[model samples]
Target: MVHETAAPASELVLEPFELSDDFYQRPHDAYDLLRARGAAHFVRFPDGGTGWLVTDYEAAKAVFLDPAVSKALKSPGAQAALGGDAGGAAMFGDMMLFYDPPEHTRLRALVNRAFSGRAVRELAPRITELADGLLAGLAEDAATEQDLLDRYAFPLPMLVICELLGVPNEDRDSFRAWSTTLVSNDETPEARGAAVSQFLGYIDGLIRAKQEAPADDLLSELISASEDGDRLSHRELISMVFLLLIAGFETTVNLISNAVAILLTDNGVRAALAADPGRMADFVEEALRFESPAGEGTFRYTTAPVTVGGIEIPAGQRVLVSMAAADRDPSRFDDPHRVDLDRADKNHLAFGYGVHRCVGAPLARMEGGVALTRLLAAYPDLVLATDTELSWRKSLIVRGLTALPVRLRP
Candidate 1:
């Protein structure tokens, strides 16, 4: 039988565990603690359940690719252990990430066209234009202190995804709000539930619209996909769109914001990138390794008893792979904590590994490369607006900045 409990934050005693304040706020410190401990360790959740937190790099890659640990539809217990609530169950039940192969493989194949290499290249011109437009607006207001995240980082990704998915321009505001609440752990359960409901309702209408009058958007393509006459069900299509919106936009937002935060704080790194725009890709890669947006890997539940990093995790136990910790593992990276844009063989688990690797990774890389490159090119003297206190989202699953205030030099 599965066990659950709620103990004092201090009693958890895991080096990688978050302090109460940090748990609800910034989690980099917690991940650092975990890295200090070792590869894998036991963690006590807020609900009192004991779960394995994998901090080692190679071990995390192993778990991510292990078919023995299934993401099948029946793993509701595993979902809950990953901090998912009832609404998450409803919306994520049919997503590609929640299923093990051959179902996972089949679904991923059908949608791969959207993110395929050729498709991403086709979208490049559009992405560049969008980035330029956003920067134009920022430039006008660059005279005073600005929240780079609010003015640029946040809207850029949302607009790009909305354009890609064919979400009506006017409806993006509501969609953005709904998507934010659904991924937020700070909100009450009821609030999240309501957000999910609203999101589903909106998506349902969009799917119907696509059915009646299909467009060339990703949603239309997903709505019409057929594999040997097998296609996504209505519910599956809705869930897929929901997943794309959250995964595509949220991750990029954090990545751009996090890269900016890191660049501003580290003058040496910032100067190197500013000096050589060609080196932006390396800078982005190191940023991803140094501080990943997804704080931890998606939750995985063991379908059969398995030993990971010498720890015996029994069947049905929830396992969390700390992407932040794994990326910083000393075994895989020398001087892992330091930001080295020139670091070679920088194969960090930032996009995860194996079957459940982020589908939108290519797109995210393209977006980050373009955004950072342009931001540096446009605002050569950008600096933090103030030495303001930075706040993180409450959700452990995602590491993101709540607000990033900065000033663009004239």
Candidate 2:
């Protein structure tokens, strides 16, 4: 598919990928057109910068695995696009996501033990218990129209991540607001800065508490890593905690909510899963492939001139994979748009590719499977209470519903 450098960056005429109406309403339609044009499209960003948007699976995988593509926020334009200041870009600092190989390797190694297979297995019972408690509350509520996102999807993951990080239940309301503000695109610069400041303050305070008296929690474990000679810096500690809270909670919230949204809308798939509980994992996989919580992978800067899908992207330009688009690329999967839970190959780039793949994916899958399975068992006739199309959160990266209204019973 390599077609040679599509002119030089300076000479190339940037076409307006005008997706105002279709972007929110039906993004995949827009993606289809973009993919047809080429593997990479020179589109305008929210910040008014033009960058390459890779929707082809092969090109995206290459971009992800290419060492020439950097994960740092060193570029001023990229920093602006990510809503970050000059000093610190998004997830900047000694965090794994912002670092390249050696640093990312070191940082990822420090916490890899915490999210190991053993750790996730141990967390299963607690997650199930939490889901049960949430379902009980939902059943008790007299309101016929219940918001699954608020009641079950949002809180379940939020509480689980908070508990893992040792964040108190009382502070969850504030945490929720901060996390939402941090992820959303609706906020102004001043608002985003304020939210970032408050979020940092809260995380710093929590970290200090964990450092003062370590407990039997993930935060305590992370804090104690310094004591064991791993030596996480203050910035790194805060960033790690911030990442876990946001990544662990926000992403899972969308996954759960999106899966339910699909089930309520697609009766055939719903009935198949309801009849066979064993297929819940497959259902979750298909959902992830279809409606990825993360629409685009994090920003990657081209360190050297690179050709993606045969188009040469000049160095110093920002680039990213459209996971939502790539997952549905016709070349990669047969009938990519269709929801098939029984597909033989369920492997998709929902979590991402290479080292930067979402670290919380294991926890997400476990929780998603448990949540869908038990929710269906508890309320067999669960259906959407509203006839309107579900509204989505206004975000450039995260794809999820603002709310999902459903009735637990007929």
**Candidate number achieving the greatest lDDT relative to the actual structure:** 2
How well does model 1 score by local distance difference test? 0.78
Q: Per-residue alpha-carbon lDDT of model 1 for 266-367, expressed as tens digits?
A: 999988876888888898889898889888746677877777877667666678888888888888899988999889967888888888888899889989
**Residue range with the least summed lDDT across 10 consecutive positions in model 2:** 1-10
Off by over 4 Å in 2: 1-13, 46-49, 75-87, 117-120, 226-228
Candidate 1, after superposition: displacement of residue 140 in Å? 3.2
Candidate 2 per-residue lDDT, tens place, 1-410, comes to 11223566566535435445336556787788889878987776554445678899888888889998888665544454445553356445556777888878877877776665344458889998999888988886524988899999998998898888888988888988987887776777677778888988999999998888887788877766632467678899898888888888888899999999999999999989868889999999999999998888567877778898778887767787899989999999899988998788787999999998888888899999888887888888898999888898877678999999888887
Q: Which candidate is the best by TM-score?
A: 2
- Give the lDDT of residue 145 in candidate 2: 88
